[model samples]
Every structure is written in structure tokens, then in C-alpha cells.
Target: MKTTLSTTFGLLMLSAAVMASATEMPVVKPLRGTVESVSNNTLTFTNRAGAQQTIGLTDKTGFVEVSKADIDSIKADSFVGSAAIPQADGSLKALEVTVFESSLKGSGEGHYGWQNADGSTGTMTNGTVGKLSKANGRTLTVNYKGGEKQLVVPDDVPIAYVEPGKKDALIKGAKIVAFPAGDGKNARGVAIGKDGFQPPM
Candidate 1:
């Protein structure tokens, strides 16, 4: 009886540990697309590859709006996040850039791997803007914790700003970048487009 009780306790402890670890894992952003329809708790959208996807939204699913911005919206010391493709000259050519609101400073602060909508790999760098110049196009230095990067923004790249949004923003034709739960059928949060601007990241 003593050995059996010890085994049961050990099993319970292991199960609890596994559950805790699973709960702490980071949410994945695997769904990026434009919303086609939205029901009470479920939404259908078209992915970048032109496939339709339907996902459920929990009550806790959050939303934010990305509004159009221009290069003039960025300034020295502005906090920003840019997803860029690495150029042969060791600089980054931006695919899209976002000037984050003051309240969102330090959100996802890092230089890390990113996967583009076309399935190509890229890098996302979130940092403070430094030494911005537009002599040729738009070039700026991004300073993060450990290092800095110089990014070249082309004329056609999307530039935007993020702000709090309402659920009504998830209407038809809305483009979004949504973070999904582990199951991949439910959304944890989404950054949706507003005022004709798409959420590029």
C-alpha cells in the first residue's frame, strides 16, 4: 500500500509539472489574412496563400488597430518595429515598419526570426529610431538592447502605427495578423487594419 501511494503522488506531481509548462509556452502567430466574415464567436478569413481559414475567438481574444502612417510619423527616439529582408550589403531592406504608440513601448522588444507571408524567412527588430535620413530613400538606425541595425525603407513599403481597437474593427476586408492558441483553431489576439491600412506584421 505504501509503494502504491508513493507512485500515485509521483504521477500527480509529474502531470502538474507538464500542465504548468504547457501553459507557459508562447502563443504562436500562424494565421495572417483578411477577414471575410465574422459570426458570434467564429471568423473566416483568407490566408496569404489564398486559402480560406475559419477560427474561433474566445472571450479573451484581444484586438488592436494598425493605422496608416508615413515616414514623417517616425522621429528620432521613436519606438518602432520593422520586419525586413536582409540585403547583400549587410543592411536590412524593410518590408514593413510600424511606429508603436507610446503606451506600447517595449512590446516584443528584440531582434528575432520572422516568417514572411510568402513563407520566406526574415528578421523583426523592435527598437528606438536613431539617425534617420531620407537622402536616397528612408534610412534609419534601430538601437535595441545589445546592438543596432540600419534599415533602408523603400518607397512602397507599408508604414503604420498601432493603437487600441474595438471588435467592430474586425469587419469584412480587414487584414490582420493574429496569434493563435496551441490548438491553431482559436485566436488569442489580433492586430487588425484600420483606415485602409493593413497590418503588415
Candidate 2:
């Protein structure tokens, strides 16, 4: 009787552990893609790998539009995200820069690794713009939580602005960076292109 009871307890504990893990939510990575079509609250798109994928969108799904911007759009106190490559002098040079809307001030508020459009790896820094200088090129001092980075935006670097968008903006050929839900097949939010502008970040 003692042996049987011990075995039963162990089985129950194992079953409970399995159940707990099964209910745990998944960590989802963002998906970058171009919209091919949208219908019935579903989005069909081609990802960076050129594979067709679909994600379901509900009424609660959020959308933000990215529009063409230039160096003139960035100013002191503006919140921005820049994808940059490090230079020999230790300062970073901007590959692309995004002027984030007020609501997105603290989004991705740190310096970390980012993948560029050309399949090269760089760093992404999202923070508040501090000072602006144009001595050589456009240099922006960006301040984040623990540190700050000085980024140089050259003449040819692409720039874009992010703003609130509606479902109508999700038309064909729009580029997007989608945040997936825990299931990985439903969209929580997306930053989609406005007009022909692709989301640089």
C-alpha cells in the first residue's frame, strides 16, 4: 500500500508540472513582411524569406503608419529609433532613422542588436533626442535609460515617421513589422507603411 501511494503521488506531481508548462505563454518575435492581400480579418504576406504567411487580425489589433521623413523632421526632444553601424571612432553612423510618435516614446527603449535590410547586423537605439549638431553631418545625441549614443545621420540615410493608422492602410505592397500574439499566428499590432514608404526600423 505504501509503494502504491508513493507512485501515485509522483504521477500526480508529474501531470501537474506538464499541465503548468502547457498553459505557459510563448515568447514571440516580430515578423517583417510585405502585404500581399487582406481579407476576412486575415493578412496574407510574404516574409523576408519570400515565403507566404498569414496572420489573423481581430478588431483589437493595432496599426501604425510609417511615412516618409527627412532630417528636417527630427529635432531636439524628439523620440527616435536609429539603426546604425559602429564607426572606427566609436560613434555610430545611421543606416536608417525613425522619428517615433509621442505614444511610442519608450518603445524598445534601449541599445541592442538589429538586423538591417541588407542582411547585415547593426545596433538599434531608441531614445529621446538630446542635442543636434550639423558640423560634419547631422549628429544626434540620443539618451536612453542607462547610457546615450551619438549617431551621425548622413545625407543619404533613409528616415521615416511613425503615426497612428487605420485598417485601410494595410493595402497591397505595404511593408510591415508585425508583433505577434502568444499564439504566433495572430497579430497584436503592426507598423505598416504609408504610401510607398517601407518601415526602415
Candidate 3:
């Protein structure tokens, strides 16, 4: 009887251990905020309400920093932001970020038209060219033909318009259009049109 009781107790203990091990682990959500401070292996960000939080840097994280080359890429008043993604080797990596500034406001020397998805066309002799400077923050100004206009581009606008001189090197005259990639997200890319502009660099 004693041997049987001991065996039963051992089985119960093993069952309890298995149940405990089956418990779910906690989930970690993505963190979002403005960078407050940056260090070699960590970054501190302030939330919308001004609360500060720090996150440890990891291989899967991304980073962006200001550089002289980046400054010359956009208009004078444009603001820039960067992002870092983590790499598989446990190091921080840089993610591409857009810079926003005012749009190029001016009259089109040649006629330009906006073709709606429904196959309707609208002409803008005084067409404005604007780009979303950063991920989704503000606008950057570009000179079209002659005037100044504000273009409210959405966030996630891909590298649509390259600098004039660099156009040949990037996309050989790609026109900007909304390329919606499901889930309510829209991306800006060169469209298939008469001009046959190239894709962004």
C-alpha cells in the first residue's frame, strides 16, 4: 500500500510541473515616441504626453541619424527623421526614413493632368509638386515651374521625386501616384503613364 501511494504522489507532482510549464508568457508591444536621448546601446523617448521611456537596443532595432548628405537632399526648411531596425546578428541597423518640407509651388511650363482611378482627367496648369518629408510628419518644398505650394503628402510616401540633378541617376522622370498596399496603407511610387517615369532610387 505504501509503495502504491508513493507512486501516485510522484505522478501527481509530474502532472503539476507540466501544467506550470504550459502557462503562457507575456507579450511585448511595439514602442512609439520621440527620441529624447540616444546612447551607444540604448535610446530614451518621450511619449505624446511628455512621459519618458527607455528601451534597450537590440539587433532587431533600427536607427537613423542626421548627416550633411541628408541635409542637402531636401529643401532648405525640410526636417528629417531616421529609424533603426534590429539585425539578426544582435546589432542595430538603419531603416530608410523620408524628409518632409514645403512643396514646389509654380505654374507648369507644360500641361500636366491628374488622372483619377475612374478614368477621369483634371488639368492643373498651376500644378504643385510636394513630398512628404519624413514618415508622416510634414511637407518639403520642391520647385515645379515657378510658384510655392504646400503639398500634404501622407506618411509612408516612398522616395517619389528625387532631386532635379539626381533624377537621371534615380528614376529618370518618374511621376508620383498613390500605390495603395492594402490594410489602409498607401505608398507613393512612380506610375505607369505616358512619360514612363522610372521607379525611385
* Cα RMSD to the true fold for all candidates: 11.4, 13.4, 26.1
Model 3 C-alpha lDDT per residue in residues 142-176, reported as the tens digit of each score: 33344434443333433332221111211222222
> Per-residue lDDT of 1-201 in model 2, one digit per residue for the tens?
333332322221122223323434211245789999999999999998999999988865767789989888889999888878989987899998989777656655667665566677677777899999976558999998999999999978889997767778888999987766555677767779887777876
Q: Which pairs, if any, clash in model 1?
A: none
Best by TM-score: 1
TM-scores for the candidates:
0.77, 0.76, 0.23
lDDT of each: 0.72, 0.74, 0.29
Cα TM-score of candidate 2: 0.76
Given candidate 1, what's the lDDT at residue 194? 89
lDDT of 1 by residue, 58-124 (tens): 7766566898888788789988888888889888999999897776666556566666777776777
The TM-score of predicted model 3 comes to: 0.23
When 2 and 3 are scored with lDDT, the better candidate is: 2
* 154: Cα error in model 1, Å: 2.1
Regions of model 3 farther than 4 Å from truth = 1-73, 77-111, 116-135, 142-146, 161-201
